[model samples]
Structures are given as C-alpha cells and as structure tokens.
Target: MEFEEVLNNLKLEKENNLAQECLNEIQNRQVLFHSGFEQEKKELTSLYRLRLKTAMDLNRDKFEEDVLANWKKTIDELESCSAKKLKLNWVRTEFKQFMIFWNSETKKLEGIFYLYPKNTIKDQEEYNTGIINGGLTVGSKKYNKGTFIKEWK
Candidate 1:
C-alpha cells in the first residue's frame, strides 16, 4: 500500500509538470488578432512593463525584499498548500508581482522573477516562468524560500 501511494504521488507530480510545460508553450506562441485589438494589447503590455521596470530599478533591494515577503505571506495564507501539493503563484507587491511555488520533486522553493506590469486580476497573464528577463531572475532551478530576494539582483 505504501509503495502504491508513493507511485500515485509520483504520477501526480509528473502530470503537474507536463501541464506547466504546455502552458509555457502557449505563452511563447504569440497570437495574431484584429489590428486594433492587437495594438491596444501591445500598448497596455508595454505600459505595464515600463512601470514595473521603473519600480525595480529605482530601489532594487527594496523591491526585491518586498516582493519576496509578499510571496511568502501568500504561501502562509494557503492552508492546504504544502510541499506535497505546493503550487507556485504570482502575488502582488508594492511595485510588481513575483511568483512563489514549492517543487516537492526538487525539494526547493522556486521563485519566478517576472515583472508583471499590472495587477494579475485585470490582465489574467498566463505563467511565463520560462522568460526571466527585465532584470528578473526566473529559471527552472530550485530556490530557498528564505533567501529568495537575494537569489537574483
């Protein structure tokens, strides 16, 4: 029974990983839309990115620390979230948004450093954890939750 349980858990983990990968692919595949709508979307995205960049560049240390703290606080609030079923998500901070998730398989808390230009609720921005640009450090590797801010500049 114990062996069976372990196998089931492993299967779930694999499924989760695959699902995440699929989502990443979708994010990378840019879509074409009506010229007007496309232009509007692009403008909004650019505006948000600019704001997020300015916030981070102004005082990188403060932005990083605050983002990390908010992510941790979010994790703390999720009663059901744990290493076994830990899921990473983007939580808002003063300047921007940061992602936090625990990869039980890797035994490391992963931080996705993305500068979300706007509030997630309005944008519904899909997870692009693969793209760690804009001076943010996002990757596939595991990270320590405690020292997340210092993980990247």
Candidate 2:
C-alpha cells in the first residue's frame, strides 16, 4: 500500500504518529540498505546474498505455509513481487525499547526484536556489558488510567 494509505489506516490507532515514523524508518532503511546494526554479525554483501539464496533450503515449504496463515496480504505481495514484511509500531517502556519487524518469509510477525547485554549473564559480570549500560534512551509510549497517553523518553 501507499504511504498515505498506510498512514490513513494508522490514524485510527492510538499511536498513529509513531507508527508512521516507524514505517518511514523501515522503508528508508530498505531503500538505503545501510548496515543497520553496527554490532550485528559482520558480513560481506556477497556472503549475505549467498546466505539468503540458501536461507530457505531447509524450510521453504513450511515457511510459506506459516506465512500464509498469519498474513495472507503479505504473501500476496511476495507472490506479486517478492517477500514483504510488516508489524506493529515501536513502543518504549521504562527500561527497554520494543520494535518488531515481520519478514515475508516468516509466517507470523512476532518476536521481541532484541533485549540483551551482548554478553551472557556470566560474561556480563566479567565484561562491561556494552549493550545494557546505556544512558541515551529514545522512543515513547502512552498509558493513562486504562486510556492512552503519550510520553517521550
């Protein structure tokens, strides 16, 4: 769907503005294809393509079946073009940030993107735990007497 159409639909949701921003960020990254995570497993573009080429080797059929179950529209888009993914907007609570992205391959748009210290509990004690020790926090959420209220962090 077009951005305007998606934005219009999101307008019905409580945090439509954030949802729009999340979508915009995702699309922009997809367009730019930037190295999203500096800490992500270092990879060469050729190797990444090779991995994707064979990524479905083991579970191609099962993967399609699952995606069909969770998001038929996404499947349709993939069939027409290639795989597409969509998910709920970003939400930030007190400590952690939550942002999930569904893939056209994965049938269900589910998973807590990441909650980690980049090291094990034991390793964290040994190491400084880079991921967890963070001061700059961004994003926001809303909750007010069973209603919604936006708060920046």
Quote the positional error of residue 14 for candidate 1 in Å: 9.8
Q: After TM-score superposition, what is the CA distance of residue 100 in candidate 2 from its true location, in Å? A: 1.7
Q: Write the per-residue lDDT of candidate 1 for residues 1-153, one digit (tens) a residue.
A: 121222233334444543243233223322111101111323433444465566557756555565544433433433333333333433333234333343435433332343434434223222333244454544321122212221111
Residue-by-residue lDDT tens digits, candidate 2, 45-149: 233335334535654554444333323332233234322433333333222233333332432322222221233323422232233346443332233222333
> Number of the top candidate by TM-score?
2
Model 1 stretches astray by more than 4 angstroms: 1-39, 65-153
Please report the TM-score between candidate 1 and the true structure.
Answer: 0.21
Candidate 1 residue-wise lDDT at 127: 35
When summed lDDT is taken over every stretch of 10 residues in candidate 1, the lowest stretch is 30-39
